[model samples]
Target chain A: MARADVLPLPQRRAIWRVMARRYAHLPLLAPAVAVSVAVFWACMAVLVVMSVYPFLAAGTPRFTLDAWQRFLVDPFYWGVVGTTLRIGVVVTALSLLIGYPTAYAMSKIRRPGWALACYVVLFAPILVSVVVRTYGWLLLLSQTGAVNYVLRTLGLIGQPIPLIFNTTGIIIAMVHILLPFAVFPILSVVGQLTSDLKEAAMDLGANRWQTFRRVTLPLTLPGVVAAAQIVFTLTISAFVTPFLMGGGKVQILSGLIYRDMEAVNLAFASTVALILLALAMAILAASNVLVRRSYSRAEVLRT
Target chain B: MTLVGADRVEDDVELREVSKRFGPVLAVDRVSLQVRRGEFFSLLGPSGCGKTTTLRIIGGLEYPTAGEVVLRGQVVTDVPPYRRATNMVFQHLALFPHLAVFENIAFGLRLRGLPSDVIARKVDDVLQLVDLPGFGTREIHQLSGGQKQRVAIARALVNEPAVLLLDEPLGALDLKLRLQMQAELKALQHRVGTTFLYVTHDQGEALTMSDRIAVMNQGRIEQVGTSQEIYARPQTRFVAAFIGEANFLEGRIAASAPDGVLVSVDGLQVRVAGDGSLPVGAPVTVSIRPEHVKLGAAAAGAANRWDGRVQDMTFMGAVVRATVALASGIAVVAEIQNDAAVGLAPGDAVVAGWAPQHTVVLAR
Candidate 1:
């Protein structure tokens, strides 16, 4: 190949123009990437550094494994980790079960105005602050709340069910808060699916249920997986909803971090925070693998 | 007139005055037609003329807002598609993306809760029937467009439906592939001996593959006849123009005779052989196919000969289409075989005429 400098003047100028055109998007992307790296990664780095600091040291920073060792040995911290994982899995499952049908209905709305109205209703809770919404759930699930009042008047139950200040309350609130995230991805995927496929299924002697099971459900798996991954990751890292709904009874990993930070045990707080991050990453990685497998299966059908 | 009466139990599919309204749009008007058992029937029309809607109505995918659908001598107007003995091959070939070829073909059988071995055997048989024996393990995406089409047909045929409804199944294929599939589909219908209710906008495909065709226009069947009859004796102005190229001459009945009707078009009298239903001095339209319009010395003994100059000549492969302007300033197109007219050119004086029996008279 000829060297760039040895090329003719006009050729060199043309190559320069082409290079400039190809790489022009870099300048536009630089500011956003730089800011994200500086703010987010720098914070993570500082958290990792501080987690290794000596437990009792004051003036000078000294590295030690005390925080990690203490966190690893404590059964209480293990319980918190287990509880957090349970909540994440349960919330993600419940959200998918509820969100898939809602998204399907939204996708089938033919008129744009009606679809927009349905989307607004589905996302209305998300427009409110998470803390406020959790508090709203708290009121709804209270002993004398509307739900209990209706149930009691109907004589379906003799007493009010214990709906708040436990894992049940936290799960219910978190699922409600994270529903829109799940619905949007599934809705978009369902919307992109051609209507002819459904008609074809019906025409091929499949009843509505059979069509859903054999055709629509399998084709929309990628959307389901994507929604699961998003809801699971978000639920694992969520703080405000758990704090408000758990009511001091459900001691999750995030709650432990909060308590440790309030007691000025910075090293301990950092250690728990890092463990939470690792657990979230583990779930996300597994979900990503599941998504890729399902995606490849879907890609095969597209051909 | 109804093609099939309620007593015609041999008819596989019958639409008796079927009508469908989607909001304010009338998709299918009061259409009545029939498909004889084991016949290859086609619903041919332009887009938005309700051919697909009529196919759907016959398949029981859409219930008629008025009239009845009789499938195999049973009134099935309210029956769902799954319960009806008909399966449709969609235009886009909607193969299930998640399933392999075997599963797609076995879908209907599996829904009926057949044994796994029986489903497998039926799927294999259908695969052989469509000529794709070893494609069971392959995903739908692995198949080419033509292969996908074959799979879709196999998926429907494995059910052993009384009638197989096809909604423009070859509309997506290239011209060469479409022609190949058209021939294969006709042969398949013959081998299976099933009533095939097909839909298409392409007149060539319709004429080539169908034993009989229902020419539809504006949500109504303009005429229903064998391909030869449809081409030779179209009943209405729409069918005459929609099926093939026709040179229309606006006229009125000058006189009625026992042999033929005399129509005067722009002061030129032309004799047309048909049942003289219209009285003298009534408005009418005369349609003549281009191939019947002889040119030059070939027009010597024709009774309705007119001297015209060729305005334009298009050299098609087998024939040359010439646009000739008559002495009355009306343009008539004549498609002459290239072998017969070797050096015909524009601005040449020509006499274009056709036998009086070939002229089709229609109400305006």
Candidate 2:
């Protein structure tokens, strides 16, 4: 855009280099983009094709609506969808209720060393394998496990409660495994909030609870929305924890997909996987709107 | 602490022997002051001088480690900020970023469970008072800096507080805007008629805006008085140095003159107008303003006259400053109106002197 004829050779070269640096991220991102296209999008296309046209039991591949009809017309399959969404909503809500306070307290830690210790305690479980953490949960939540034993010793229950192989076990494990995702996003947003906003609210005659409700909660809603998006989608699509904890009792969408895949029903498995993807995408899109609204409202520009 | 002055109904806010300690540092050290009802008072000091800490103590945001705080003839030392009948316009203006301007101003009223119509009416009234009547629907981030400042002020003033605490609310503005806001705030205070306890490090701002100022230094009140009193008759050396530019001449009392005291500075005797309380030979520092120093023929009737040579001259817009070296080899600056003199350059001989009343003698 500059007058190139008036510039010297080295200056022109420098300008060209600056222009080249503007798009430097394209080459840097090429490898990841290529890998995702080949392994994710390409596989997704193959799965879409397999769901509608399949060679099953030595029959030639043909386009048919059998898998779609079987999935859509069946009430049992619809129940699996219901269970998946119900667990997702319930787990997301409980995680928020528990994670919000934890994140707020963590953000309020004044000392670097203590805050670091809290971060380590909160996130160290994520480094361990999900299967291992779920197994640990099973050990803790079994009928004769430490949880029931503690309840028995406290005289709260006369008999060991049925704590595993049900919806309750799946939910408990899912909340535990997905907690860091919830707390991480919320903490990131809450920590960015300045204390002066709350003080301003109080100085304007709002009491402590009023200050939290009117100022603190609204300003930190973006983080809460992001946390919900993550935890909700993760809870819905999660397989290992629910599978191991539910012990074939809870029939979630992921479990259905795994069952069809194990029975060599490629068409049905592909259909279930696409549905799970669509559910996650829909929730993400909805929360993305929420996040945008919250972000715009809470946009603090320093002058 | 005894709340003996609760019967003094004229005082809007009082800090009696109040102190604040942050960890090991004493941020406010036994500071005691009172804000008269319906007066614009300011605590002026440098950063880290604890002026803000004292303001916060009065607002009930920070409790004093000792002593008591009285507000409108009531001992409110234990009252929290929300329970106290006071509001603060914070330094950064701390407008609620999530709320529209209307909601931001309506926050306190809404918390009190006022009806929606009443709240809306009150918010509109305050917005009109701050000169932003129709800006209720605008978000905070969309407003300019000056608009936000008005919103912050309106938010506090809408509560009709007994005393308004302001912590350098204009510190974020540019110089031109700061001056404009300073005049606007002074006018607003007059119109509202609320007792304001303002804190700032700017002496000029305090002098131009406050009815009285408490000059602070090193976490202590150096002096508190009217602007003219504090400027012309500072009770401490720190106040003398901090308020304005002054030439300090360290000396000892040579003798007590008939109406003042004569101090010997570098073998020259300078007469300073005062009570003559200090005994002879007591060490002191004599401060004289450059503008008060007369030059040329104007020095003929001055009480302390000296013959000096101009060493340097700086031409300011309206005033010219001439650094004059006296016969005793001491340099004193004399500021002259550029229009009042002619042809006085560097290295020229001149008579520099000031009246005895113009010299302030501080005990060393």
Candidate 3:
């Protein structure tokens, strides 16, 4: 066989050209890349540039630490940061608590038609607009809505309980929005688990609950962690659900940034944006470390 | 029904008219079986023959749509798998991947709320019994195939179950390892004295390991007997074809004598013993094992003899198999020892014969 290294220059150049031509679909990705750069990266760059500029600038690009310093030292901004994190943590926990069993049931459904129906139900909210879904929750949680009316008729309480215009409403709405995220990854993992393993667990004298705790739970932990990461990060940066459901009662970081931007205080808005970005990054990094450690632990058992 | 070990009539497990249905398919159809105490009984069949389903029913992992499961004289038809005094060694050796060898074996003990020290001692004892000493800390993925198999068996045996159900546990191993595990499992059953209800499609494994085997076909058992009885006197065509190599000759009963029956196949008369109850002129099939057929010089003084042409000769390591074409156009295979059948060739004319007792007559 003729070695490629020893081939004539012209022949080698021809082969290289042929290999390069094999990737003819490279230009097909141009539109997606262009949109990503033009919209997301450019906006982020502008935000970063405006964040360092001095506050109350009169058409002059003078740079200072005034915006960053004020935001960092403000106790109100700290409360906003804490609220954002609390909402993220609470929503993530609720989603997981509810989603795990739903996904497990979906995975165990043997009939294709029933499983397809479940898939449609899971992704139906995603197909609808987020604003529409939040409005649906708004109607459900309102004082005179069906829930309160039913509770009143049943004489469960004397007065209408506060559900909307508070953290409770935001949490309920966010969990509904993020449940599909939590379910899908866990569902895929659960679907991959063989029936034989479960049967073996039972045959080895482990009851149903013990089998789920020891075998099924541990095996699907990676998926659960992935779902948590997605839900947590998304809830941290969420705007529309909190804005609509909170009804100005819940002061979150994203709402503060939006308020600062609406007032045309670009410097302060950019500063709040940067703080949000940093917090999201920090939380994601911490979770990444936790996920990696857990993965390695699972890997040890596997190997 | 002459039980192989009739001295002890107490049964370890019994299935009475059990039937299981999946959708429209009857997986196990009204099957009844009895496993005596301390006996190694095998449900032997081809794939999809419902042997594994029957074993799973005994393990309580599968519920029979109709009938009862009796364990140690108690009707346990509705008992779940965890509540039963039975554990299974799965076909794939489904050892818990997350737990170490020790924890996997001690899972049942821990569920019973046994003390740590007692659990440890029991796990250690089972590990040693399975010849896996000092392997308690090793994870499942770190073990070899045979080691994993031992762990699976050990995991079940540690519970000290009254009946150990094995669902083709050695089916995943390679040929050499499968043979080795077969002998080890048989020895382990002997030492533990637990009734073993084993299920396998491999005839060789069933024959070598089982004290008695129930030959299953479709969804029902054809016959249940000792390996020798199953091999020598199969009552059904499926059993005769499934258990080993047999050359079947279709015939009718020519005469019934005090000692045996005379079967007329084509134009030839074949004498068969042990089937004298088969009425004369009844249609029957005579099954004869390949090794039982005497060829050429060995056919001298035989009760039934025939002239045949050797069509093909195959040299297996231990035995030489010859495909012989008889005068009536019926073909039969005969296996002879390699040393004695060295000179036989494809075109050679030979006289093939089998003793009257070697022939098994089955009604069509």
Who wins the lDDT comparison?
2
The digit string of per-residue lDDT tens for model 3 on A137-187 reads 999989988888999999998899988999999999999999999999889
TM-score of 3: 0.90
lDDT tens digits, residue span A1-303, model 1? 469989999999999999999999999999999998999788788788889974534767888888999999989878888999999999999999999999998888989899889978888877788878888999999898878888999999999998888999999999989999999889878877887788777877778998888778878888898899899989988888898888899999888889998998998888888898898888778877867765676756545
Name the better of 1 and 3 by TM-score.
1
Question: What is the C-alpha local distance difference test score of each model?
Answer: 0.89, 0.91, 0.89
Which candidate, 2 or 3, would have the higher TM-score against the true structure?
2
User: How many clashing pairs in candidate 2?
Assistant: 0
- If scored against the real structure, what TM-score would every candidate get? 0.92, 0.94, 0.90
Worst 10 residues of 2 chain B by lDDT: B1-10
Model 2 regions lying over 4 Å from their true place = A1-24, A56-59, A290-295, A299-303, B1-7
lDDT assessment of candidate 3: 0.89
Candidate 1 regions with alpha-carbon error over 4 angstroms? A1-36, A55-63, A299-303, B1-7, B308-312, B339-349
Q: What fraction of the real A-B contacts shows up in model 3? A: 0.75
